[model samples]
Target: MTLLLPPTSEVPVPKFNMADLTARLLAPGKPQEAQQQSSPALNPPDAPEAHEEVRERRRAYQRPAGHPSRQERAQARALAQQYRDYAEAWYQALRAWDMREVKIPYSFHYEPGESDLDFLTLGSNVRTPTRYLQTPAGEFTEGEVGVVITTMSRAPLVEQMQLGKMLDKLRHTPDTTPVSLLREDGRWHQNRERVARYAVAVLTLAVQLRDEGAEGPLRYAKAVLAGAH
Candidate 1:
C-alpha cells in the first residue's frame, strides 16, 4: 500500500526592510515625518520645575481658605446650635396638635445673622397655629405666626438704637412697609418685627417671673406651646 508524504524542504520568506516596515506600520500614509528624538543637552532641566510651579499656582487660585478665623468659626457653631434649639421649640409647638388641625406642609428657615435675625416661617395664610391666651378677642388665627430671634449684639445702646428706629416706623405710619434701614437691608422689616416681638416676649416673661411671681404660668404656657419637654 502506497502512502502520501509531505515535502521536507522549508519555503524561504523575504526579509523586509526595518525602515520600510516601520513606515508601513507606524507612519502609514504620512510622508517622511521627522522622528521625535530627545536631546538632554539642548533642553533645560528646570522646564519641569517651571511647569510644576504653574500647576501649583492654578491649584491655589482654584481652592480658597475655608474659615478666615477660628473665633468666627466658633461663633458660627454657637449660632448653629441656637438655631437647632429654636427649631426644636417651634417643632414641639407644632407637633402638640393633632395632624388634622395643623397640617404644616412647607416650613422654611433663613439665617439672617448679618441682619441680626433668624426666622421660622409658615406659609399658610390662615391664623397662626400658636394661640396666645392673652390674645384679645377676635385676634386668634390659625395661619402664619411663628417666631424670629434677634442675634444682634447684647449691648443696650445698639439694641435701643435699632429698636428705636423700628419703633419710630411702627408708631408713625402704622403700616407694614417691607423695607429695612440697614446699608445691606437684606430682610423684610416684617421679619425683623417678628424677631423684635420674640425679644419683647423674652423680656416680658423675665419681668413677670422676677416681680409678678408668674413662674408657674410661664412654665405652663411654655409647656402648652412647646409640647411635653
Candidate 2:
C-alpha cells in the first residue's frame, strides 16, 4: 500500500490579471443597457415647448402680514358664499343651455271673396315666438286700434357675457385681463388666473353636486391652462 505524504513546503499562488478582472467587473451588460434605457432625460426649463405651456397666471394681491384681520376674514367668507351661489347658477345655466329658437304669429284678414280654406304660405325671418290671445268668443279682442308688436333677437337668451368664451380666453389671456370678477350671472370680469380658479371652483362643486363619490378629490384647473380653443 503506497501512502501519499504532503510536501513540507509553501504552495505557489497564481497571480491574478488585474486588467482582465477589472474588464469583467466594469463590462457593459444587459443590466447596464436596461438601466440606461429606463433612465429619463432631463428636460430644459427654457425649452420652447416649456414656454408654450400656459400656467396658472395670476396677479399678486396685497394682504396684511401673518394673520388676516377679522374684517378680511369676514370678507373672505362672504366671497366664498358668493362663489357657491355663482356655481349653482352656472350649473343651472349649463343644464338649460340651448340654441335660440324663436317663433312669431301673424294675423290674416278674411276676405268675403276668398274661400274659408286657403293656402296660407307663411315664411318670414323672426327670432321670437308669438302666439295670438283670443277672447272666450274665439276672436281676438275687437276694436284693437293699435298693433302690439314684439320683436326679439335672441339676445335675451344670453344676457350675460359669454361664459364659454371667457373659459377659453382665460387659458391664453394676458396677465392684465381680470377674470376674478365672477358675477352672480355666471359671467366674469378681467383677471385670467382668478377666473380660472372660479371655473375650477364651479367644476369641483359640480362634480360634488352630482354626488359621483369620486375617490380622492377633483382639482380646479387654471384658466391659463384651459386653452382658448
Candidate 3:
C-alpha cells in the first residue's frame, strides 16, 4: 500500500549556489585592516624626518672639531701659568741649595769652516761652552744636554769618565746658553726617558736636602718634580 506524503510548499528547501561560492573563493583577498591596526607603524608621523636626523648627527660630530670655547681657553691659560709658577719655584729652590751655575769649556773636533774659529787658525778645535749646576751632591744640566750626566761626588771614577765622554759628544753653538731642566713646553723634551731620569735625580737631591733641615723650597720642588709627568 502507498503512504501519504506532506505538501512540497510546507517543506522548506535549502539553496546552494556553486557559481557564487566559486567567485568568492577566486576573488583577491582584501587588505587585513585589523592586523594593520594591531601592528606598529614603520615611520610614525610624529618622528623626525630622515634628513633632519642626519643633520643632527652631523652637528654633534662637528662640535668637537670647532674652535675651543672661552672656558676651555681660560683653563688652558691658567694651566700654563701654573706651570710657569712651578718652574720659578723650582729655580728658587735650586738657588737656596747653594747651587752655583758654572760654565765649562767644551772643545770638540769639527771641520775647519763648520763654525767661526775662536782663533784665526786652520784647525778643527771648536770650543762650545757647557753650563752646569754645580751642587754639593753632583753637577746637574738640562735635558737638552742629550745625556743624563750627574757627576755625583761619591760616583765611581769609571762612571764619571764615561759621562765626560758622553758630554763631549754633544754638539752646540758657541753662544748657546744652558736650558732650564724644568721648563715645560706643554710636552716632554726630545729624550723623554732621559729627562725623566734627570727629574728623578733632582727629586732625590731635593729629598736629601729636605732631610738636612731645608724644608721650605725643597718641599715645593719635590711636589713639582713628582707631578712633572
Alpha-carbon TM-score of each model against the true structure:
0.19, 0.23, 0.23
With a 3 Å backbone cut-off (N, CA, C), the pairs that clash in candidate 2 are 103-128, 103-129, 103-130, 177-191, 178-189, 178-190, 178-191, 179-190, 179-191
Please name the candidate that would achieve the greatest TM-score relative to the true structure: 3
Winner on TM-score between 2 and 3 is: 3
CA lDDT scores, all candidates in order: 0.34, 0.35, 0.41
Per-residue lDDT of model 2, residues 49-117, tens digit only? 432321100000112123465678898667654544444344333332222333655544456566653
Query: Model 3, range 124-164, lDDT digits (tens) per residue?
Result: 35454545554433455544222333443234776445433
Superior candidate under lDDT, 1 versus 3: 3
Write down the TM-score for model 3.
0.23
Off-target runs (Cα >4 Å) in candidate 2 are 1-66, 98-101, 105-229
Which consecutive 10 residues in model 1 have the weakest lDDT in total?
Answer: 34-43
Q: Write the per-residue lDDT of candidate 1 for residues 1-229, one digit (tens) a residue.
A: 9974333222112233344344333644543321211111122234567445444433432333342355777886665444333322322222232122433345555755646433345353334344331121112223222211122222256643453344333323434522222113322123434543433333232332242322333343344334322
- Model 3 accuracy (lDDT, Cα): 0.41
- Please report the TM-score between candidate 2 and the true structure: 0.23
Off by over 4 Å in 1: 1-66, 98-140, 143-229
TM-score of 1: 0.19
